[model samples]
Target: MCYYLKLKYFTLHGPLPGMPPQFLLGNLAQSGLLFDKASLPEAHIAFKQRYGDIYQFWISSTRLIVVNNLNDIQYIFTHRNIYDQGDIYVQKFSIVIPHGLISSKGAKYKRHAGLTLPLFRRGKIVSNFDLIVDCVDKLLIRWRAKSPQHLHLDIVQQSQNLLLAIFGLIGFDYDMETLDNDNDTNKNELTKALQYFLSNFNIMLFSPKILSTIYFKLSSQYRQSQKTIEQYFDRMIKQELDNGEELIAQRKRTSLIASLVGSLQQDEEMEINKSEEDRKGLSRNELLDEMRLFLLAGFETTSTALAWFIHLMSKHPQVQQNIKTELSNNNSQGLLSLDQLDSLVYLDCVIKEVFRFCPPINGTVRTLTVDDRLPETGAQLFRGDQILIPFHSLARDTRYWSIDPELFYPERFLGADKDHHPYALIPFGGGHRQCTGQDLARFELKVIAARLMQYVTFGDGGNQVNSGGHLSKLTIIPKHVGVTIDFDK
Candidate 1:
């Protein structure tokens, strides 16, 4: 223990502050801070109260500096070149998405990111508006079938199926009949695989190599589920390769898979003259990795956000009524267009507030590249040390917003908190590494929220069912999101 303390002192700044009487396990028990599988944000909040904005903790030999201050986070993220997604993320996510953009670095990252950027641009996203509406209409039809009963619905399950259907049609040009049929074998298998992976990911990533190997061998279900999910993606990639070009030319901007294929082909042509090391473009396996990533990320995060939004709306019925009024006032004809979706300003505020209040992802981690001192505290950071920018903490910090940050207030965006610090509310994150699909995510939320408000009234399922607490999966999910849906006549 003395030796460990001395080593920590020599490597990091002396006795780096935070909760004292360090746990015997050296914060490995608190690894949830990184993955956020528990109430890690609350723990971080407590740490901030005790130790100010910047503090250090250890997860085995690894040292993490948690930065809860807005200014510090802004500086760190803005200076993107100095930091890269940490090895912890790469090691864990690579198990599921080996060569995907999220896990790749350097020239490969640049190539993939460059190719993918065009597909997610604002205009390109807007062009898929019809596809989104079509998918949402199907969902509404499903809800209508359950209408007049005022059914107590599982918002999480409903949202997941809805987004999965949308992602299937728009993302891959594949029809995942998740909405029409509840027992989609492939969908259930994939969801199970994702859940198992997320639940066990941190342990596998952070454990010693030998122990991790043993654990992997012992967890046969996890291994099989991973293989099953990968095989499914492989099949999808093969289908795309076979038909993507013709489909792309016909549907143009509507199919994300088509765009990805087009980009891959363009890269292949560009790489023809280059040496092996100089070559850039996705191989079949690489494409499979990216497709799986898109499928999971496209649906999982958005559905979780929608679930949280529904739960919040149920809790605050007045807010729900206001959104319905806004939708009705904006589109009197009862049919929504992309232009009209954009015009529903209060709904936009509600969406923004939902993102701010219950961000699906708690935060992301970056690894330091060189020795540096924090601008605010002059705290020293050595190369390879991990920096954690807690997004939840910054958004909820009392010092940054004019209004109380804890309250579930959508009007804050429209009023006093309108001009809060730019970095204070980074729900999708900030700088170069921020989520590229944010526009698509936001657009999806608006369309769904608008459509739902137009057709159904979500009533509170009472304290037993709607009581707010989060389940920290790969994203922060609303644990108890039961709502009573009253479909309009």
Candidate 2:
């Protein structure tokens, strides 16, 4: 039982309806109660049972206002002037993701988001559907021919392959594709450094970047990989820059880099005279930041999502059957189309439910911009305090969900009572900070689910996988568990 607020002699009226937090630690040690899977299904069940809907919980001395009510969320996320992406323990990301949209906070975030917003508009993403579909279709064909040996294809590996393909086809006009997840996914040396950067990122986070400075500076392996990846990125960027005028003139957009390069070039020579630097919006380093961001961000979350999808769907064959039934003949061709996603509403519902069940991201933190009090719970917080919105907990909150919110029933999503609060079902988050790649991520999940359901009947292999998956803050991932999969036809 977590304690509620303890008032000081100098403060306002009666005891505030909040939790009694640890003296200095706040609730960081005991705060796990907020995240407990057993405690999560019921929204504010743990908090309300002990601390009410809006209670103060501390994380390693950082204050977080844990909220379950709908309106409070709207007020906090909408009134960005008061609350923004919180002061984070970003030591983990500084050397890894560094300065991209995912780890970026404050007005700096808004600027980057505003500038890069053009690339992901509906017109562009929709236009590249064929490229995405082609890759999925090819993977499906490979899966269909598999021999009947309980095939627990490590989804971790498979997802990277798929993401790498996306990078090649749609993101960058590079033709490099890898069957294995461990090898080069790109034709350029840039591939090496990007992979090297992420694999070692956890170490830097758990330990410290200062420790790796020696290794990064002295070692041949780390240095070489960095050089290769950086060089390839430059080569690609330079090629695009050199061909900027002609590429746009020819109206060819083979990859994201090409598209970006074309977009940068002005219609006439007058544009160049203004400033060469203005014409090239993202410097070489800035381009790498975006590239690494998408590669890791896109690949990891979607892959883990697919892994979890397989984990749950395989356990529940009936659910998989229903998805296949919905997919029926609609997915016979190479890729599932946007129209197909609409028809397969149940499948879509299942994905939504899955996100609700096991959201791939834990709560993301934001720094307090101003002091404000919650109208519903009446908890007041000050400026500079950090707030973590636990999406994983929110999705499973029984207070907001239907009958035993922990139960994974896709049918629960079908009813007229499906008007959930924006913050209520936030696997992709809400408000301005919401995920930009949501459409592509959902489409990819559907295609992978449809592909696996079409050909493979999967079962859990009895080794060790994170029983519930590990939370990396960036995305939650299932550990290496041997799963047995049998072929359909």
Where model 2 places Cα greater than 4 Å from the true spot, the runs are 1-63, 89-92, 97-99, 102-108, 137-146, 151-153, 180-192, 203-224, 249-254, 262-280, 329-338, 462-473
Scored by TM-score, the top model is: 1
Which candidate leads in lDDT? Answer: 1
Clashing residue pairs in candidate 1, if any? none
- The per-model lDDT (C-alpha) reads 0.75, 0.61
Clashes of each: 0, 17
Model 1, residue 350: C-alpha shift (Å): 0.6
Put down candidate 2 lDDT per residue, 1-489, tens digits, no spaces. Answer: 122233331112234455555543344335353343332223334555686565665443344566666677777778777777655545445564565666676554654565565666666666666666677666656555565554554666666666666655566676555543344444344555555666665444333246555555676777787677767767776777777577655544324566555434334355435553344344445557776665654566676687778777756778977887777757633345668756777888899888877777665555677787867666677787666677866776677775577788888778732776567788776667667677667766776676566666776654454244444533665555455667665
Determine the backbone clash count of candidate 2: 17
RMSD of each: 3.7, 6.3
- TM value for model 2: 0.78
